[model samples]
Target chain A: MSQQLDLLFYSLSDQTRRDILRRLTLKELTVSQIAKPYKISLAAVSKHLKVLEKAKLIGRRRDGKNHIIHAEPKTLIKIDSWIEFYKQYWNESFDQLNTYLTTVGDTKNET
Target chain B: MSQQLDLLFYSLSDQTRRDILRRLTLKELTVSQIAKPYKISLAAVSKHLKVLEKAKLIGRRRDGKNHIIHAEPKTLIKIDSWIEFYKQYWNESFDQLNTYLTTVGDTKNET
Candidate 1:
């Protein structure tokens, strides 16, 4: 796939993954429970979890026979900050700050 | 390529694309002007532009013989709102909004 905001967003783009995130948002749940709502195989949900984990959008905790997933908000916040930077396209001060931020350390490596 | 945030962010993950975006942030430039800094051929820059256009990160304006690229901030804001949603992973009231947003959305069809 692409990489930057792409990976982070695409991880979320999938309907199954989104549902899983929604279910997790409601409350952390076991893998099977998270998978229960979908018609796909449990392994499919497992793959989605792996993707979410790689994206760091969610973290998994082993609880008894099931793995419980919790949302990790930091990376998500980074994406917000990046997206929020676009406001600079319209706001002057935001523009200056964006110039500073984009040109900041290793931004070319952003994502 | 993955369609969700993945496609969006991944398009951005490349150093060359980031530089192109940085240049655009400074001012809109023709495709050739945008291609000058990169050691790669114009064809490569053109390819990147295609990716950015598909991602909707930038829009093109054909002026004379050049294509002037401009940033499209709306989609970025959508990403922001999405990332912002995870903030609800902590804030309870935000949780209500999250449910309202995600479940209300074609959650499974997210991207």
Candidate 2:
């Protein structure tokens, strides 16, 4: 599971791959079409797509001659769940700290 | 910014590092104390701590003879924001797809 997440985050760490995901979110497009906006070669774009695909962040389908790519939002959902768990953990810690401070204040006032 | 994020995610991409983060969420501990739970050498644990510190996921303080370490939740907040942005984008794409499909269904029925 950690390895999978590592791949997911590593794939997302690149600007080109993130941009590719953003573009795919708008609409499904061919590798050539996705590569058109960037200065990088189609091969480079394909490489980025492979990384995203390996991370399961994107899906590809062969459309006769062109390869169509679409963003797989489910993987992002998994990432969100992981973040949500830690976010809750962090918030709870803050709440505990707040409660501790309040108790200390009350004790001081009582004295 | 991208480079910083790259470092952040790369640092998080390890199981040992993630476990260390989970431990720090509870309370601050010295380097030796943190190393006590894992089977790895103290030096290995220190290396993981350094990675987490470099990613701004944790902070360290020198106290007398002990180096106290604490989780830095703020960096995770940044990561949450990035994930939130993409989540919204993904949701919007889903809505658009839903709308498009409904329109196509209605058009088919009309013909």
Candidate 3:
């Protein structure tokens, strides 16, 4: 699980790869179409795709001679689970802070 | 924004760092207490703390002779936002798949 997360987070750490994933969310696109907006070479775009594919964040299928890429958003659910743990902790901390502030306010009013 | 995400994701890519974040979420502890569980040297744990600190995922405060470390989960809100986009996309794709399946089911009934 940790190894999978390492790959997923590492893949998401790059701008080009994140952009590629976002584009794929819109619709599947051919490799050449995916590369068209970038100033970098097709090889560079292919490399980014490879990283995303390795992380299972995106998948590719062949259509005739072209490679079509699409986002695999289910893989991102792992990250959502991880972040949810921290969100729960964060909310707990906020509740504690609120309680403390209320106690302080009550003391001030009594004084 | 990309650079910050890069740092945040890169910091989370390692198991040790993720573990450290989880531990800190339980409660703030001194630097030495944070290092006690791992077999690695205090220096190695310190290095992991530095990476987490750089990503703003955790913070430290000096108290007398001790440096207390705590999880700064608010920084994770950025990740929540990023993941939220993918979740929405995933839901939309599932809806489209459901609609397609319904159409196919109706056609089968007609036959």
- The candidate maximizing TM-score is 3
lDDT of 2 by residue, B1-111 (tens): 877787787777787888888888878899999999899999999899988999999998899999999998668877777777677666776789889989787465576
Give residue B44's lDDT in candidate 1 (0 to 100): 93
Shift of residue A102 alpha carbon in model 2, Å = 6.7
TM-score of 3: 0.85
How well does candidate 2 match the true structure in TM-score terms? 0.78
lDDT of 1 by residue, A1-111 (tens): 235455566576676676677678768888888888789998888999999888887898787887888766656665666555567664666667777887785356666
Q: In candidate 1, which residue ranges exceed 4 Å CA deviation?
A: A1-10, A90-111, B1-10, B13-15, B90-111
Shift in Å, residue A107, candidate 3: 17
TM-scores, one per candidate: 0.68, 0.78, 0.85
Query: In candidate 1, what are the lDDT values of residues B1-111, reduced to their tens digit?
Result: 236455566566666776687678768888989999889999999999998788887899887887789766555665565556667554565678877887779367766
Off by over 4 Å in 3: A97-111, B97-111
> Tens-digit lDDT track for model 2 on A12-76?
77878888987898799999999999999999998999999999999999989999999986688
lDDT of 1: 0.73
DockQ of every candidate structure: 0.22, 0.43, 0.68
Comparison by TM-score, 1 against 3, better one = 3
All models: lDDT? 0.73, 0.84, 0.89
| Fnat for every candidate | 0.39, 0.46, 0.79
